[model samples]
Target: MTAKQELKKSIIASVWFMFLTFPIMVIKVNTVTHTIDWRWHNMALVGIGSFFLSMLWRYLLKKKEEGGKKDKKAGLSFIQRLLQEKQFALPGILIITLITILFPHIFSMYQTNIMTSALIFVVLGLGLNIVIGLAGLLVLGYAAFFAVGAYSYALLNLHYGVGFWIALPIGGILAALFGILLGYPVLRLRGDYLAIVTLGFGEIIRLVLENWNEFSFGPSGIKNIPKPGFFGIEMSMQTTTIYVFYIVVLLVVFTIFVINRLKNSRIGRAWVALKDDEIASQAMGIDKAKTKLRAFALGATWAGMAGVVFAAKTTFINPASFTLWESVIILCTVVLGGMGSIAGVIAGALLLILLPEYMRDFGEFRMITFGAVLILMMIFRPGGMIEDVRKTYKFEK
Candidate 1:
C-alpha cells in the first residue's frame, strides 16, 4: 500500500478506537444529601485505560509496518516453556498458601475466619461442579443437601450424643441418599424444567424444617455444635484450633485434586458425553439412568462435605442459613467460572463469597451490586472465565 493510503487508514483506525473508548471513560455518580460518590469509577478508569492502550499498541504495529521491520520470534528452552506454563493465578495461590502455613498465629482472628469461609465455599463449588459443570444438570437447590448435612450433625450430636467426626460421614451419607432420591424422579428433566424442580425441592426442604417445629425447633436453630477436634485435642482453645484451618484447606485441595482426577476418568467422560448429547451418549452404550444418578450423588456428596465443615466452623445450625439464595450463589459460582473447570469454579467461589464479605458495608446495595455483577458477567461472558472441552467418550456396548 502507498504511504498516503496507509497513513489515512491509520488515522481512521485511531479515531474509531477513541470513539469506542469514550463510553468506558464515563463515570457514574450517586448523590445523597450533600455527599457524592462515584459509582464504579475504578472500573471505568481501568476500562478506558485498557482501550487506549490497545489502540496505542495497534498504532505501534502500523508504525512498524511503515518502517518495514520483520517481526521477531524466539524459541523457548525446556525450563522456559515449563515456567511459561505457570498461569497468572499461580503466584497468588502460592502467596496465600505460604502465608497460611508460615505464620498461622501472626494473623488476626477475623482473617482466619475469612480464610475458613473461603475454603468451605471452595468445597461447595467443587461439589456443584460435579453436578452442573460436569454432568450438565441445572441444580437450583444444592443448599438442601447442605441443610441435610448440617441438621444431621445437629440432631445426631444433640440427641444421640454422636461426636463431630462420627457424625460427619453419617451426615454425608444421608445427604447422598436424599440426592439419589431427588435425582430418581428428575433425571429425565432438563433446562428450565430441571431448574424449577430443584428449586421446589430446596424450598420444600426448607419449609419442612421451618414447619417441623417439634423436630427442628422451628427457627430457633441448633446452637453450640462441636467443631472438629484435632489429635484428640479439643478445639475449644484458639491456639490449637488454628490447626483446623490447615485441615480444612487440605480438604479443599484434596477435593479439587480428586475432582480433577474423576473428571478425566471414565465416569467423568460419560457425564460430559451425557451433557453434550444424551441420545448420542446412550446410543454409544452409556447407561443413562446410572450416569444421572452418579452425577447427582457426587454433587450432593460435595455439598454434604461442605455442610459438615460449615456446621463444624459455625457450631450452629438453622434452616435460614441453608436457603435457596445460598444454592443460587453456588450455582452462580459454577456458571460464572465455566462449568467443568476446577480452577474456574474455585475462582468463581472466591470472588462470589469474598466480594460480598468485602462489600458488607454496602448494606442493601450489596445485593443489588451482586445481582448486577452476575447479570453483567452472564451477558458479557456467557461461557464463563474458563472453558472446558469434553474428552472422548468412554462408553462401550
Candidate 2:
C-alpha cells in the first residue's frame, strides 16, 4: 500500500478507537464530589498514540509478510545454524550457563526470587506446550492442575508432616492423575467445548477449596509452609532464596532437555499427527484417546512440579493464588514465546512475568500496556516471538 493510503487507514483506526474508548478514557466520574470530569487530553493522547501505533503496526505486518516470502529462499535461520553448527553452539551454551550461574549471586534476593518464579512458569509453559502446542488441545483451566500441586504439598505437610522433597513428586503424580481425570470426560469434545469444560473444571476446583473449610481451610489458606531444607538444616533467608534459585535453574535445564528429546520421539510424532488431523492420525493407527490422555497427564505433571516449588518458595498456599488469570498468563507465555519451541517458551515466561513485575510503577496501567503488547504481537506476528523451527535432515550415499 502507498504511504498516503496507509496514513488514511491509520487515521480511520485512530478515530474508531477514540470513539470506542470514549467512556473509559475521555470521561471520569467522581462520586464523592459528585462531579463529572472531561478529559479531552486523554482523547487527544489516545488519537495521537493510536495513529502512530497503527502506522507502525502496518509497517511491521508488511515486513513480516515480506520476510515470510523470503524464507523459502533463505538458508538455516540463526537459531537453526547456531544449534547445528559446532563453532557457534558451544560458545552459546557456555554463555547461557555462565549467565544462569551468575544470576542469583549478581542480583538481589528479591530479583533472584523473581527469577525463580519466572523459571517456574517456564516449566509450566513447557508442560502446557505438550498438550496445547503438540497435541493441539485447548486447555483453558491449566491453573487447576497448578493448584492441585500446590495444595497437595500444603495438605501433605500440614497433616501428615511430609517434607518438600517427598511432597514434590506426590504433587506431580496427583496432578497427572487429575489431568487424566479431566481428560477422560473431554476426550470426545474438541475446540470451544473442550475449552469451556476445562474452564469450568478450574473454577470447580477453586470453589471446592474455598468452601471446604475442614479440608482446605476455606480461603483462610494454609500458612507458614516450610521451605525446602538441605539435609534437615535450617538456612538463612538469603541462603534459602539462593538455594531455591539454583534448584529452579536446574529444573529449568532438566525440563528443556527432556522436552527437546520428546520433540523428536515417536510419541511426539504421534502428537503432531493428532494435532494436525485427529481422524487421519487414528486412521494411520495412532490412538487418539491415548495420545490425548498422555498429553494431559504429562502437561499437568509439569504444572504440578512447578506448583510444589511455588508453594515452597512462597511458604504458603491458597485458592486465590491459582485463579483463571494464572492459567491465562501461563498460556500466554507459551503462545508469546512460540509454541512447540522450548527456548521460545522460556523467553516468553521471563518476558511476560518479569516485565509485568518490574513495571509496578505503572500499577493498573501496566496491565493495559500488557494487553496492548499482546494485541500487537498477535496482529504483527501471530506465529509468536520465536516460532518453532522444524529441523531438516538429509541422507546421502
For residues 1-397, what per-residue lDDT tens digits would candidate 1 score against the true structure?
5756655655565456555655554433345555445445554555556556655656666664554444321322233333336484598678877876865577777778887888788889889999998899999999999998888888888899887778778887888999999999998999899999999999999999988999998788889987787667645557545765776788788897889899999899999999999999999999999999998987888788778778888888889999988998889898997788787788888899989998999899999999988886775556676555444456889
Model 2, residue 308: C-alpha shift (Å)? 0.9
Pairing residues by index, what is the TM-score of model 2?
0.91
**After superposition, candidate 2 runs with Cα above 4 Å error:** 2-4, 14-50, 73-81, 394-397
Top candidate (lDDT):
2
Per-residue alpha-carbon lDDT of candidate 2 for residues 1-397, written as tens digits (9 for 90 to 100): 8889999999999999999999999889999999999999999999999999999878888987888777552633566455567788788889999998998889898899899999999999999999888888999999999999999999999899999899989999999999999999999988889999999999999999999999999898999999988998889999999999888888888888888888889888899899889889999999989999999999999999899989999998889998999999999998998888777788889999999999999999999999999998887767777778775668999
Q: To one decimal, what is the Cα RMSD in angstroms of model 2 from the true structure? A: 2.7
List candidate 1 segments past 4 Å from native.
1-96, 235-237, 389-397
TM-score of each: 0.75, 0.91
